[model samples]
Target: MKPQIACVLIFLSVGIALGECDELMKELGRSKTSLGGLANELVELRQIQRRVGRRIRSWEDKARQNEVYLGRLIEQRSISEGWLARFEEINRKLLAGEISSDDKEERIARNIVRIAEFQAKIDRRQATIDFRIGKIEKAQAQADLYRSRFEARESVVADIEEQRDAKKLLVLTLEADLEACKAGMA
Candidate 1:
């Protein structure tokens, strides 16, 4: 009768130990699953960050190009203004009859055509400059938008990192508990 009682007690202890081990295994499994999900989230966030960075770079390049084109347009307008000024001076002289020449009428007609052409060029250049200015404004707006989105995502990434760290710590704790359980069973 004493032997039978000792055997039943041992059997109950083994059953309790097995139950604890099973519970620990389940907990460890849950921790591993949570860690994997966090890692996947981190990867997705990094991809989003890279894409936003690319958009910002593209906007910057477009803005730079617009600036270069605007500069050229300004230079062209300046040259055209100078030519128009010179032509106006010549026309004024011709009208004033400051010089007498056999081909005075022909020279006047030629000067008038040159002045018209210079004025047309100046007008065209001004239009182009206006258009480029609009484009530059649009590029700047796009860049600002990208920057805003990037900053928002960066904050999210930081949060995710913190979550990942916490999950890592949880996993370590779960693993330590599993090791202790195994040692107890041994």
Candidate 2:
């Protein structure tokens, strides 16, 4: 009877240990699945961050290119202004009869026309530069928004990484514990 009772006790102990082992295995599976999900999430977040960075760089590039173009347009307008001033000075001299020319009237008329037309062109270019400046400002604002989103995602990724690492440690511990438990059973 004593031997029979000892055998039943041993069987019960083995059954309980097997149950624990199964439970530990299930927990380990769950941990691995969760780790995989976290890794995938981290990857997706990184991709999103990378895209945002690209967009930011693109916006900055656009702003830089437009700034360079604007500078050129401004310089062109300055040159045109200088030319217009000289044309007006020459036309004034022609009108005042300070310069000797047989076709003085015709030359004055041509200078007037050229100054007026060039002024109009300069105004149009300035308007275009103004509009482009506004657009660059808007693009900068959008890039700032993307930067904020990237920072937010980076924070989330950090959290997920910490959780994943902890879960990985738990899985390792469980696996080691399961092996020890199995050896004991054997």
lDDT of 2 by residue, 1-186 (tens): 999999999999999999999999999999999999999999999999999889756887888888888889889989989988999999999888899899998999999999998899789988988988898889878888888999999999999999999999999999999999999999
In order, what lDDT does every prediction score? 0.92, 0.92
How many angstroms is residue 156 displaced in model 2 relative to the true structure, after the best TM-score fit? 7.8
In angstroms, how far off is 123's CA in candidate 2?
1.4
Q: What's the TM-score of each model vs. the native?
A: 0.52, 0.50
**What is the overall TM-score of model 2 with all chains considered together?**
0.50
Looking at model 2, which ten-residue stretch has the lowest summed lDDT?
55-64
Global lDDT of model 1: 0.92
Question: lDDT (0-100) at residue 14 of candidate 1?
Answer: 97
lDDT of 1 at 61: 85
Give the Cα RMSD of candidate 1: 25.0
Clashing pairs in 2: none
**Best candidate, TM-score-wise?**
1
The residue pairs in collision within model 1 are: none
